[model samples]
Target: MSLFAGMAMDEESVKAGKLQIANYKLGENVHLFGGAFYLCYQKGLINWLTDWNPDVLIMEANPRYIATPSAVKWMHARGRKVIGWGLGAPPSNSPHFLQKWGKRQRGVFLSQFDALISYSQRGADEYAALGFPREKIFVAHNSVAPAPTFQVSRPKFHEKPSIIFVGRLQARKRVNWLIRACAEMGSKPRLVIVGDGPEREKLELLANEIYPATEFVGAKHGAELTPYFAEADLFVLPGTGGLAVQEAMAHGLPVIVAKGDGTQDDLVRAGNGWQIPPEDYGALVQVTREALSDASRVGRMGEESLRIVTEEINIEKMVASFVRALNSLRY
Candidate 1:
C-alpha cells in the first residue's frame, strides 16, 4: 500500500501488472516540543492487509510516523515481504547529535525490512555504509514522465534568452538566489518563475525591485508546463528536489541546480547540466554567466540533456527497474 493513491500512474506501470493503491487519511501535521506529530487511523489497516493479501509491501522510511513502523512489523509477522523506500542520506550538514542518533535509529528500524529501496545510487551506497547488506539494497531512481513535444524551433543566442524555474516558492527552494543571480548578469535573460507558495509576494517584490523582466506564471502541470519548457533557453532550481530537472531535460532544456539531495547527482551531468554548491551565490552567478555566455553551447547542452532522458532516465526505464526489483523479491 502507498500513501499517495491519487498519484498519477503512467501507462507503462498500468500495463506491467495488476496494481492496487491505498492511502492513509492524513491528519494535520503539528510541530511542538521540538518535534513533529500527526495522526493516522489504523482502524482499517488490518482489514485492508487481510483483503489485499499482498505478497510485498513498500513504504516510505520516515521514522517520525509511528503507523509505518507498526504496519511493517505487522506485515512481517504475517510472513509478507516488506520494503522501506527513502532518501537514504541525512540532510547535508545535519547536527552531529541528530545525525548520530538518526543513523542508529534507522539502522535498527530498516533492518526489519526484507529489502531497502533507495531513491538513488548515492542513497543505496549510504545504506550499505550504514551496514545494510549491499545485496539487499536496490536503486530505483526517481523519474518523471516526458513532457509533451513542443514544435517550436530552438532559440538563437542573440535572441532574448529565457531562464525558467519550476517548483514551490519556499525558503528552502532559495528562488531568491535565482533572482539575485539574474540581477548580476550583464545581459539579463527573461526569468520565468512557475509555481506559487508563501514566498510569492516576497519574490515578486524582489523581482520588481531588481529584475523587472521576471515573470511569475503561477503553478503549472502536465501539458500546461510544456510551453514554459519549450520557450526557455535554460532551467534553474537553486534549491533541492529535482524532478523538474528531468522534465525540463525531456523537453530539451539544459539545467542549473544546487547540490543537496542526491536526486541531482542522478539527473544532472557534465554535458547535460551543471550542479552548483548549495547556497554558494558566487559560484551560482559565475556558472550561470559562463553557461549563458555561448548560445550555441546552450543548444548543444540541451541536445545532450534530451538524449540522456530519452535513453537513460525516462519513466519507461524507471518502471522497468521497479518491476525488476519487485519481481526479484517474489521468489
Candidate 2:
C-alpha cells in the first residue's frame, strides 16, 4: 500500500517505521489560526494517481484539501473506488455561517466516496447526522500500536500511586489540569508528565510551584516509554486527543481520559476507566482519587484495560475494520 502525506505543519511530523511503502510527500501547507485550520492540496495528486493507478484510493475526509474532490472524480471515472477516512464530520469550530458552509462542502465531498470510515461510532453518528448514508460509514477506533506481548504486572499497590500522562504538552492537552488534580489529591500520587510541546515551560513552572513532586521527563517513546507505562498505576489524559489511551491500556494501565474526540466513547468504557467532562476539574480529582483508593479495584480495572486492548481495540483490530470496509466496497 502507498500513502500521500505532507510534512508542512509541525503537527504533521511522524515517526517513520521500518515498513517499506510508497510514501509521497506533496503540497505546500498554508497554516491559518496558528496551525489550527490549515490546507494542504497535493498539486501533483492527479499525476501521482495516474502513475500509481491503484484500484482504490483512501484519503482524509476533509474539505480543506482542495485536491480531494478532483482525486475522487479521477478515481470514479476509472470505475475505481475511493474511501474517505477521518476523525468524523466537519468541525463546528468556526462561525455559524462558516460552520454551515463547511458542513455543506463536506457533505458534497463525502458523497462521492464509495465508503466512509470514522475513528469512532460517535464520529459515524455525526456523519449520519450530516445526511451521509449511515450504513456506508465504518468505525476503525483509531489505534496507536499493537497490543503488548509481555506481561504488564505490578505490585498490589505502591506506597504512592504513580499517575502518568503521555502526550505532547500543549495547551489543549490540559496537562496543567492533571497536575492541579494530582496536587489536590489527599494521597499525593507521583505524577509523571511525559512528552514536550510549546506549553512545556509554563507547565513545568506550575508543576514546580504547586506539585513540587511532579516529574517532568520531557519526551520518551517506543522502548524508552515502555518502562513508564509498565511502572505506572494509572494513566490520565486531562485534555483532548485520545491516541495515547489505547497505548496506556495495552500496557495494562487503567485510563482516566477526559472526553475529547468521540473516539474516547469506544475505548474508555465503564469497567476499564472513567471519562469526565473535558474541563471539569472537580470530577477529574474525584474520579482519580476513587481509581487509586482501592488497590484491588485498580488492579481489576487494569485487567479490564488489558482485555479491551487484547480483544476489542488495537492496531490489528483497526486494520481488520479497514479491510472489512474496503472489501465490502469491492463487491
Instruction: Score each candidate by Cα lDDT.
Output: 0.77, 0.85
User: Ten consecutive residues with minimal summed lDDT in candidate 2?
Assistant: 25-34
Candidate 1, residues 1-331, lDDT tens digits: the string is 5342222223212112233664443223332243234333334555566666677887776565456777787788888888888878554356899778878887887787778888888988888887889888888778868433544457655377789999877877889999999999988888999988778999999999999889999999878998888889999988876578888888888899999768678878899889999869899899999988988888898888888887777777777766776777877
- In terms of lDDT, the best-performing candidate is 2
TM-score of 2: 0.90
The ten-residue window of minimal lDDT in model 1 covers: 6-15
